[model samples]
Target chain A: MTSLVLAALLYATPAPQANVFTLETHWRAEDGSDRAFSTLKGRPFVLAFIYTSCPGTCPLTTAKLKRLDAALKAQKTPLPMVVVSLDPEHDTPQAVHHYRERYALEHAEHWSVFVGAEAALRTLTQLLDFKYAQNPESKQIMHDNTVYLISRGGEVLTALSSLDDSSAPLLEQAAQSEGKQR
Target chain B: MVRLAALAIGVLLSSATRAEGVLLPEGRFAPLFGLDKGQRSFAVAAFRLDRRLVTEAAFAAFLRSKPEWSSASVKPALADERYLSQEGGAAYAQAPQTRVSWFAAQAYCEWRGGRLPTTLEWEYAAAADEKVRDASTDAAFVKRILTWYGKPFRREDLLGSGSLANVYGVEQLHGLVWEWTLDFNGTFMTSDNRQDGDRVNALTCGNGATGSARREDYAAFMRYALRSSLSARSTLANLGFRCAYPATEERSP
Candidate 1:
């Protein structure tokens, strides 16, 4: 009888709130090191999804990231920027390294590229509300172009949806967050 | 004692059979939307689909194992306030589990060692009727589905409800609850108004579908609209999901 009561109480108890880092997905960085998403906690960061082979939008996205990086660096609040591949099977470590070199992000200290299994990628995408689909026959990927600025606690602070959208607001928020940390 | 033991074994055997689900054969299908320019039909791979919607009893068992998905425990980011509104009690045990967000449904399917069916797979399985596998073109069949869509929500026991099994032995594909698909958000890219610049212009201009494959497929259009309107965490009182698995090799009899 006592055990039954205990079970009933346990059943009603609430669980912890879910955050982006709470998802148990692992990824391989361009440097060939495997790590979980939780390891990136303790600071604000920029996150976006892209495939190295995307003929359209990806180039523009990379340019936007570079601009954002420059803006942040100018402000002296340099935050790490993570670009996760939408097509994980194609974005191997070598492909990611080549991509970095092609874009001249090879020596950028604050930039990281990651690739993971499709299932893990899907889990993270779903959590972040990023939409993407891959056509099997054409090997083309259709995806959203939203870029997220996440808080140190893993909440999405801001999202920029278009390539033309200015990063002024995002820069302001990051600077504020960095100020808070100091 | 012997009779009880026999009953227990029978129960286990039946559940094992049910766990295998129904295998759908690979085929070419023209879905309502998402067709590439000049593409008529796309090939859908063979997969195993759950015969019925996930029941409240089954979801309750899932919650027991993963309490973080419970309505009280779930974060607002993962599920809305209406998540699992009709959750507990034996009254809802046999009914289709509703008020579940797509994330929660996907989690449950993953826990079951399967995944949510893609929008294409769900539409393919739902295209069936009592006799024909692809009754989507039949005017009467389309009208029947539209009628269900037009009706208001009401709680009903799914087990003996008039929703008969389709040709593939899948039940309650329609006339029950709206289901969550694996890639629900991927269907209509143009609907996302936040997009601007050359990408949006390329999609909105002549590149993507100017109109649906068959304009008469109003029911299919409604389904696509509902899917596009929903966020990943959005939950309605009549939304639920079923699992789909990769098909294994068929054994010779």
Candidate 2:
């Protein structure tokens, strides 16, 4: 505790915020195109993680994202969305594409599905505080099904952990945090 | 040229010694909480682990090399103000570096040419006692480990890097501070964290796919509970970490 008092004296204020989106986290799209999350800078977006073969909550998570997107469009202009696969080993580009199709999100404007190496996914997960686990017995990946809404400046506006939570508040918060050109 | 080659090997050997890590041969051991409740044995590739919990001094040196990781430099996004508090000063450097965020711990391991051990690697290597490889079933050992959990943390108790080495010479897997696992969030015990909509069920009904392998291990259950309660940016007073590296070559018998 003494160190804390000394540290507080040494640091009168907290450090400045860091950019959440950077060119480092690159993803391979269903079309085999690679892009970093930083490429979406100056654009508000939502990020979700799922896998095609997941037997548990992945499908329900996607459906919620769908509703969220629809709600956002109904209120304001549609925002950009990206659904990443937590099971990158099984979630090939083709698998993500089929998964997107399974949700009837085909050609959904500003919404893209991408798959990449676990290394890249790991970096993104770190940035977003996203956590996932694979069960050896079930061969199924378990993860925190949470969606991160990022403002134009790459600031995480809020995180919705429960699927039952309303998207209206998150969209409203995003609306307030968007596009001042950081 | 012979002398020069010998000097190069000397430097390499000395640097490896400075790191003070021990190798655990590749083997299979049941995790405290396996995927199923049966406690079936699973294979874990060999790896190296630090002999002791990382000290505040060791972490401060790392921060000096990478100021972006410094408590003063890391933003609120990556870490909260609690990243390095009063215990962050030079005087306390000899103590175990607690209240470290998981991201910071991961970076420290990487900086040292290692990474945090996966959940299984940690549990497997920790199962060893000084005399036997898997001493987890021993009633005395199990009780001793669980007893550590019951004791409340005191500043006097956590102020050092000293911990008894296990059979494999890995130290403080249980009695010391709670170390970070590479896959801390990988284990499932509480609920389906991935599921989105909760309104329909709201009554604790899961799809029945997820369950712990060793449900009786209350100590492991507490470990998972604590881990699940934390986020990547968390910096708790009693939470610290050590580094682990992948085992590249087999140790000749």
Candidate 3:
């Protein structure tokens, strides 16, 4: 009977794959719509975390994303990009709009900017192994500057630091993911 | 006599609910890491902390309630292969539940209407001794903690073994399993170097130690290093966690 029970338990176990969409989190998109991360599944996308008001590496990360977007477009394998805010308290819809305009992402249909409460953000960030902490006094966020290429199943296929590493690897994987989707 | 009995029952109910955890007063503490430039100490708010580590039986109860977090169902990305390997039998019911990933710990705390304590808050509460609060600077106390750290770990030791209650009435901070903090991955060494325009190789050259507030506090340093080394999914046999809750607002009579 114990062996039979063990076999049943073994059969019940599901195949393990890391999918960020599996996390239960909600966010407000730049368009003022409440969306669950699962909505982004079934399509390959580039994911990055940044706050609209970050004075340091965030702007660099945005510029890097733009460059990656243009590079992927040239390869005819354009993937949608997701930019989540680390400072959800300050990254209101208006702030995200201004940020999109400032970075010339206003007309980019493939780009999405999202802001959510800290708890939801933490759930996503922890899933991706992204680290961030906000200073209590200065309110400036210290964070890693990695850009990820997520597969259609929401697994991180490749990640590269925006400041130090070239986006060539991420671009290659994103192109491959786009090809698979097609 | 009837009125007195009713009042006594009311007091008993209140104390029973409160016995699950202990309240720690607000204070400032200088942790081993995460201090900004020229920042000395972090101001921690008053909070309630669990009196003991979560036990195997408690975790079993959680797994029963949330089957998705069970070893068979949890995603590999959220917890490693060793997740919940310690079986909860009658013999080990009271033992501290180890081999739990940070995500599982967080979920358990949330289910209990609380959250994992921040690193600063955990360190501040842990600094207290049995008689004196903030005994982190006492050389003898530091030595005793270091001794505990050096002792060879045995899983059997987790049973019926824990530190005496500190000033906050919280026990088992040391000489027990390592606990998870809310932001265990928030170690700012490599990321801070990029912000300061310093080469990443500087961390390898022992420059990370230069930012520590107390170089002699090797126990704290080890804890910080362990926290930095762990991913959200990493689980260790000697690692467990307790929950913390926001302090209730005091009202004047």
User: Whose DockQ is greatest here?
Assistant: 2
Which parts of model 3 have CA positions greater than 4 angstroms off? Answer: A1-18, A31-33, B1-19, B189-205, B248-253
**B22-114: candidate 1 lDDT, tens digit per residue:** 899999888887667778887899999988888887787689779999888986777766678764478777678888887889889888778
**TM-scores of chain B, in order:** 0.85, 0.81, 0.85
Worst 10 residues of 2 chain B by lDDT: B199-208
- The 10 consecutive residues of candidate 1 chain A with the worst lDDT sum are A1-10
Off by over 4 Å in 1: A1-19, A31-33, B1-20, B157-162, B189-210, B249-253
lDDT for position B220 in model 2: 62
- In order, candidate lDDTs are 0.77, 0.70, 0.79
lDDT of 2 by residue, B133-223 (tens): 8877777877777777777667667765444788888877777688788877655543333354432221133332224444446566566
Q: iRMS of every model, one decimal?
A: 10.4, 6.9, 9.5
TM-scores across all candidates?
Answer: 0.85, 0.76, 0.84
User: Residue B185's C-alpha lDDT in candidate 1?
Assistant: 74
DockQ of each: 0.18, 0.25, 0.22
Who wins the lDDT comparison?
Answer: 3
Compute the DockQ of candidate 2: 0.25
Candidate numbers sorted by TM-score from highest down: 1, 3, 2
Stretches of candidate 2 exceeding 4 Å from the true structure? A1-26, A29-34, A67-76, A100-109, A116-123, A126-129, A158-160, A170-182, B1-14, B17-19, B37-41, B86-95, B150-163, B188-216, B249-253
